[model samples]
Target: MSSPLTLAPATGGQRPRRLLVVLGGALIVATYLFLVTVQPAEIAGGMGSVASLVTLFGFLGGGALLVAGILPMLSTSSLVVMPLGIALNIAIGQIAGSLGMQIYLDAIGTVLVAVLAGPAAGAATGALSNAIWGLFNPFALPFAAGAALIGLLAGLAARYGAFRRVYLAPVAGLVVGAIGGLVAAPVAVFMFGAAGTFGTNAIIAVFRSMGDKLLVAATKQGLLSDSLDKIVVFVVVALIVYALPPRAVRQFPFARTHRVLGGRTGALPAPSPVKAAHGGGSGVA
Candidate 1:
């Protein structure tokens, strides 16, 4: 596997250095796109709107920075595992939908990236997961920021000893779920105009029927729906880590967080299944 840490971001060969330079250039362009766009960015090319240019620039620029931010910490193993994370977010996410479950169960890949790598890697994974998912379903683009939040928070919680004890796992889940819900509410409002996304929109519509304002109803749905989904996501991640053999766990980026390595073995965990390989996809711009 490729251990990027050994390559040294600042020192390594010219190739690695060039990679950072290119990523940096993309970031610069992304900024201009964001600020200079003539209109608000929209889906489906924005039909010649400057927002379309922003979306393109922003996607490439922001994505490059997000991934490159984790380059130094990524092992070849971590890199291999990244695509798998995106695959899980897309595939299993549908299973939950197919079953008509209230929870999303979509962040499986996001959580995986976090657990194996550090929060940065996990953040990259989460953001990319949504972007990839968007490729097939443009409606998914607005939620990239939300997914990124899920991954970052989950990874940070794990980093800080959240997974060290069995009891703490669920607590972490609730926290992540609440935050994910809050973050997603605005995105839903932006895309669907307070009707919310499909799965949770039903709930949002109910809230609206009850006389809630557009943003309020959407936020309420987010709190309820996202909370349930992310709680499930976090808890499952914990469980997966708990069940993993030390060797399997060790190869991941955040292996040090495992209670097995941290001198505890009795912590409760939530969920995940590591297949180690899968195809990839993007969400929206």
Candidate 2:
């Protein structure tokens, strides 16, 4: 059998590229904060479209920079996988929202990309997912920062072998969910006045009725919603990834390099001498 395709070894520029990814993610979050806090409240009424435009462009630009940094590292498989991830996120998230479910399983694709690619690609996927989804649902725009956080954390969790077992995935998801809630709470409360799905609003109202502050109530609601959603999402992602053919999983350079799926050390098998003689070499797939 032919050897699996292998990515190039780490290069000196990897650090700089990673730095760019960090900067891009930060910029996206920063833009979100600026709009929510710095912009006048009037923007909510007369300038809502403009504000939405700013959010869309902010995420788009940040995503661009992030994608540029990871471009070299991405395999052809990743290119194909990203769109699938985006589609899954939008379709499932919309369905959940329409049903007014308590949890939004929107970040499944984001977590999947992070597992297969890396933190940067995962973050970009989340940011861009919201930006694109914003076209159909503007409410999703403000939460791009939170989405990016989920992607970043999920990728980090996978890098550290969180997906090595089925149970560990939910633990990682819980951690990601908390951080995501922290980031999303302010956006939801300040921008939309805690407006969300029926279940989400009901949770916030319960907290409010219990004498919790508005922000605090919204925060609790976010924590509960995000944490529960991520647990299911992470578990689902783990199962889906593990169910994939090993050969297909191995196509992801990040997964192979980090042994994310917990297999034989991700070491590439020796190339066939005959293929080598014919100038055939492994390429990123």
Q: lDDT score of model 2?
A: 0.78
> For each candidate, what TM-score against the reference?
0.69, 0.74
Please write out the lDDT profile of model 1 over residues 42-157, one tens digit for every residue.
32223434443444455455555655655665667777887988998899878887888766688888887787676767777887888888899877775665676677788888
After TM-score superposition, the amount by which residue 165's alpha carbon in candidate 2 deviates from its true location, in angstroms, is 0.7
Clashes of each: 27, 0
Per-residue lDDT of 104-216 in model 2, one digit per residue for the tens?
A: 78899999998998786787688778878989998887677678778889999999999989999999999899888877876675566678878789898899889886667
